[model samples]
Target: MATHSSEINGPDVNDPAINGPAINGPAIEVDRLTVRRGGRTVLDGIGFSCPPGSITGLLGPSGSGKTTLIRALVGVQIITDGTVTMLGMPAGSAALRSRVGYVTQSPSVYSDLSVAENVRYFAAVFGLGTAEADRAIDDVGLSTAARQVTGSLSGGQRSRVSLACALVARPEVLILDEPTVGQDPLLREDLWDRFHTEAAGGTTVIVSSHVMDEANRCDRLLLLREGTIIADGTPADILSRAGTDSMDEAFLSLIRHSMAGGRSTDEVTS
Candidate 1:
């Protein structure tokens, strides 16, 4: 899927129809959000905005604060300082959680349940009815294996089931953390295509991934290091700034450049 440069910028991110002072503010807005674990600052003063209807990729090396930032957005980890708003509401609020679907790296499926049964179970948990649940299952292309036991399915198939469950409630924002881990390249490509299709149809997707190859598919890339944003722009923009041809090289170049000056990334502190 191809993305236009303009979409990667700040404008036209959220749905103007749902326009409220906050919900229409930005698809995601983080300001000085600091998180600490065991007295160590995992994320410090990180901030960014993801406009509505855009596919924003969170890219960084492991231990660069990607997971911490993700947790902050969903109101999972306690914020030591600052604020996070999703669709204009404060993060972790009931309203916000109700409208945002989250899929984590770990397979959260019921291993013993049939694929269809697993979907049904999640749907019920999220308060979806039979028709809605069935539609969600079909949307993720899990209809064929609907009756297959989840424990017996391949890893890729299990991921599909998890995705279906996430989308079952039709939330306005979908947050995926390393969604394609453990999948082959072909499957990852297919998943990217599916994400593009969904995003174009009006879902705001915030995906955290270390896969540089998939970075180009995102509307915008948020490069993080040690919980700070090193760079935020389209893949081409970052490449241009780093004077590199590939996202992989650009990331390394930028990281070295930022560290040389004693900075983490864009979110780095003095």
Candidate 2:
């Protein structure tokens, strides 16, 4: 992780384009977000912002509310307190629905369908046309596999297909939960390159992942522990705060500090 105290800019935290959100606009903003499962609190006062044109990775251990947070962002989970705003509107709302694209942990595509068929299905579901859907498939380097049976594809290949399906609608906010889970390191690297390319092209991307190295590739990160934000900032900011050279070391140091004190990082955002 890298650290810099200077304020970072892009879209607000929720917008997919975190680097240059709507030419001086916040893409996503959350304030005092909290979520509970049944009666158990899963997230407590969680808050973070992502501007457009940048990539923000949601990192944490298993059951740390990473999925819960992503679900809240994409409208699958409701906030018990606080608010989640995307593109200046509430997430999961009808207005944000057209502008927000999401790929869940499961491949949401039909295994029996062809790659192109899956893209077309999503296009129809998203109200996008063939031309745009085709372009999106090409964007993710899945053009060659368009005619193949999706179930026959390899894991990495399926991941790419899922990504392409998500992009078919050209949504401003793209939320991905464990997008690269099954991919090997090499393919994962390639996916990150594609992610960067998408971000540079002005897409706001929020991804959830347990892969530390993949998290390092993000422009900014929100680290979660026990369903709460333990650290939030650019990688460098976290690294500096942890007083370590590598992000892994920084994360370990921060975890140790938290265990010693029985607390998350002291920093809290409104």
Best by lDDT: 1
Model 1 lDDT tens row, 1-270 = 224664574334344543333344578899998998999898888888877678999998999888788888888878899999887788999877668888877778998999888888888888877788789878777788888899998887788789888888887789898989878888788788778767765677899999898899998888888878888888788888889798889899888888888564343221
- lDDT of each candidate versus the true structure: 0.81, 0.81
Model 2 misplaced stretches (Cα beyond 4 Å): 1-24, 262-265, 268-270
Error of 1 at 266 (Å): 5.1
Per-residue alpha-carbon lDDT of candidate 2 for residues 1-270, written as tens digits (9 for 90 to 100): 122322353224334345443545567888899998899899998777787777999888898888889889987797799999888778888877778888888787888999999898889888888888899888877888899999999977887788889888887778898989888878778788878777766778898988887777888888888877777888878878888778788888776777687575456232
TM-scores of the models, in the order given: 0.88, 0.87
In candidate 2, how many Å is residue 254 off? 1.2
The 10 consecutive residues of candidate 1 with the worst lDDT sum are 10-19
Steric collisions counted per model: 9, 33
The C-alpha RMSD of each candidate to the native structure, in angstroms, is 4.4, 4.9
Candidate 1 structure, TM-score to reference: 0.88
